[model samples]
Target: MMLSTDNHAPLRRTPLYGLHVSLGGKMVPFAGYDMPVQYPAGVLKEHLHTRASAGLFDVSHMGQIALRPKSGRVEDAARALERLVPQDILAIAPGRQRYAQFTNADGGILDDLMVANFGDHLFLVVNAARKDADEAHLRAHLSGDCVIDSLADRALIALQGPKAESALAKLCAAAPSMTFMDAGPHEVAGLPCFVSRSGYTGEDGFEISVPAGDAERLAKTLLENPDVMPIGLGARDSLRLEAGLCLYGHDIDTTTTPVEAALEWSVQKSRRTGGMRPGGFPGAEKILAHFDHGASRRRVGLRAEGRAPVREGALLFADATVGEPIGKVTSGGFGPSLNAPVAMGYVPTSQSALGTKLFAEVRSQRLPLQVAAMPFVKNTYKR
Candidate 1:
């Protein structure tokens, strides 16, 4: 879920807007775009359908950018980008993508993004709400070394589920061979597109970036498959929540650091204190300190003891009668796959151990919850 911050700005429409409307999608404003919240199948069935088969998502509102190095070398672009994110962009091999975050000088998260090495230039897919700020950040820092090209004419769609590979393979012969995180240009449905064997859903899938003009045709062709269905933002949120994936602005934001967010995995050893090129990125001091020592708070998975879904912003406490909120839920909902209420939140490291019991205040009642392992539903990524 994308949130609309500015109510005055006219909502932008994606290339597949017509298709979504024709398919009976419930339109809503999200991140300044008119996006589908759900279809006639409703969020529950759509979420289950994706887990059982394939689900197509219109993620065209996301920003796609190309970082072309002035030296005509991909390494230069990678190195330039490394200055912004904590991830080791220099080691990313061609046709592979890696998740990363942009950190602030105060060690807070600016935004999280995916960086793909395209051999010649670096490709970036950033959150819709932060795209403008992200582009401005790049221009402010790396303008002299790289050329930033915003791919506004492109539309991004995700085909995700157990049957994603088979469905995509019918159109793109190379789909089956692409492993997790593999990203590159390919002929998808007779249209030149950038295809990545990765998605927000924990299921095996592909995120295809196509030209605006051909997006609707490609989507229609994909939906022609018996196993594929058009998914909306509602199911997308619940699906990702069940998969233990983070949603920008909610689960993560400028107030949260990558270390506190339990995203230290994205920070490679090469960027750590002892490595060859360490501590150059923004907030290296504070972030690395958290790595060397530890963060006071940690993001953990929560399983509500009862049926009540502990939604975001619910205060967490040590007991049913609480003195103060120790933390707050960042993302939470009923997991359709798990058939239970699941949530994620930050808490004191002391209270973040697995199986540690806690309580969440909801509607004047402090309900019981436990610190459980993530991915309430098992992930099916083709790793």
Candidate 2:
């Protein structure tokens, strides 16, 4: 299991170690990796650069898991995958991808992941913090008909922001042909790689999976471009927050159903409503019910005009009535794109409507807040 916790804060190094140190990257322990928290340029500059230009993130520490044909047939393996997630796995076209979560017996998300079909195999990228547990969970439940392979030596990098395409085009112009949710094999920084036109940030970007040995070379080559800067975890959180994207273990967890997480779009209508394929995966009965009855505490956006930013675990109340704590702030931060403090969390359906007035307790003050629409900033998904 990639999640071995032998060293709680053990520092694992990626191939880009030397380059990061050379560039004055302030390294820290994150998900078992000696990661670059920020560079000499500073976190604010890095965040602004990514919003205006492009930023490259070395995320090789995340899990790269493969579910091979258990019954020796890719279709059969895909069918088995349906038992784990609510997505129409078999319907995925070659080079296409889908986002889903591993559900526990009670129908709560274990870990959110992106599953990509490469015609010949299924590739996945999971959170680094939950990599070990996620891999074990997948392996334990996988039908004996398939086998799981771990790409332990793989390095993943994300080139994100507005100018990502142009920066990447220097290496593989063919990447432009792929639409959102599409992935294709391509080379960048003179190394073999896989490029996906999908990211947690709402801006256009690509997630590249490369061999561990070549990650450093690729990172250096991309950084050589004046347009590319090294972004840190701080910016990553702010970017995803502005995108209204959920961060597993924070915005979602085993207790939060996908429906409540407002990720129903990931569950294809055809799969849920029953067309060519039927829903028989675990907790389908309960999950489908949410589709019909609607989730009670829904994940929604909150925009507080005040300068004070609400942090996680803050209790939320509806209007002046402080009833049962309606919900709590999951992920909150300052959005560079919005130029204001933004927050997102779960709130009762009664108080989830747009413009619904709510109060967030921050620093002993009842901060007046309102539920705002998600994507705190508009998305620029390049079709």
Candidate 3:
């Protein structure tokens, strides 16, 4: 994941900085924050541990905002937000959340986000690198109807794995009862927190947003659980990649639309053409047109035929022997769970079908790969 573009700025530290250092975390710059790339267990172990048991991640760097409607109705806030993203925000019930993207007027993505209906208000979590822009966008557009409160005094953490429920339930008794995408205020470890039963790792997990002052204590308490290990950005990236989740700057960006990124499922039918309230959002014209017709290129999974892992920015080709560049690998790395190299990239729609053969140029050598189904691993989200 490309954390930040400007490297000269001073790196900020999260509330868990001390905890990470104490745990022997290897610190690195990420999204203008001094974050841990991995702990003493290493990236491979952290990745496997998260898959086998549970892993705790410090994601406080991401931005969190609360949108309160002036009219004291969440539906009003949802309707106002509809002018920004294409998702069916009005359909989000209290204590539930949905995935969405902020698109530019040109029909390109600005940033992908998670929006949760918290009864009286809507909670939004945006990418760390794009938080400032997103906040400004919201303020510039919805200031008249909504009160945007940026929750900078809170810390965010994600606990993910098959054992996540049991581990979190030990501290937050109500954790087990919430199903996937459920989001609301809850008392966790006797501390007030905003809990969401969702994650980027494709595992059953909860993202807890707690007061910054109590974050360290909550992290330590969760770490006391035998199944939970401190994971860093390295494992977090691989986990999400293997799960087929898009990294904001890598897989999807200003140049890519939701349809081209294979995220059409997130654009609900309610917002598409012929829906009750349609074509009101930014880029709705071009985006919805892509829905009606089709995008020239599509994001597809690439399975390398050999053990060599193809990194990002590698140029793709149609034939192994001779051909011009056909596509490019946006996110590529070794999938620890699959024990093989997997990648996601954009290819011509004609070459995007499953089982279609393709080649990626790695170190001047063309390596064979094939278009494959995504989620390299099956998602274990709790329904």
Model 3 lDDT, full chain set? 0.95
Q: Write the per-residue lDDT of candidate 1 for residues 1-383, one digit (tens) a residue.
A: 56687889999999999999999999999999999999999999999999999999999999999999999999999999999988899999999999999999988889899999999999999999999999999999999999999999999999999999999999999999999999999999889999999999899999999999999999999999999999999999999998889999999888888889989889999999898788889899999999999999999999999999999999999988948999999999889888889999999988999999999999999999999987888889888
Please give, for residues 1-383, the per-residue lDDT of candidate 2 as tens digits.
Answer: 12234565557788788888988889877767888888988877888898889999887878998878845566777787888888888888878888988887777888889888877678888988888997787788784856888888888999988899888998887677777889867777667788899887788889999998888888888888999999877787788888899988889888988899999988888668555665677777778888888878899999996878888888888755556668899989787777888999899887789998889988767798899998888888888
Of candidate 1, the 10-residue stretch with the lowest lDDT total is: 1-10
Q: What TM-score, computed on C-alpha atoms, does each candidate reach?
A: 0.99, 0.94, 0.99
Clashes of each: 0, 4, 0
lDDT of each: 0.94, 0.83, 0.95
lDDT of 1: 0.94
> Which is better, 2 or 3, measured by lDDT?
3
Off by over 4 Å in 1: none
lDDT of 2 at 292: 81
As for lDDT, the candidate ahead, 1 or 3, is: 3
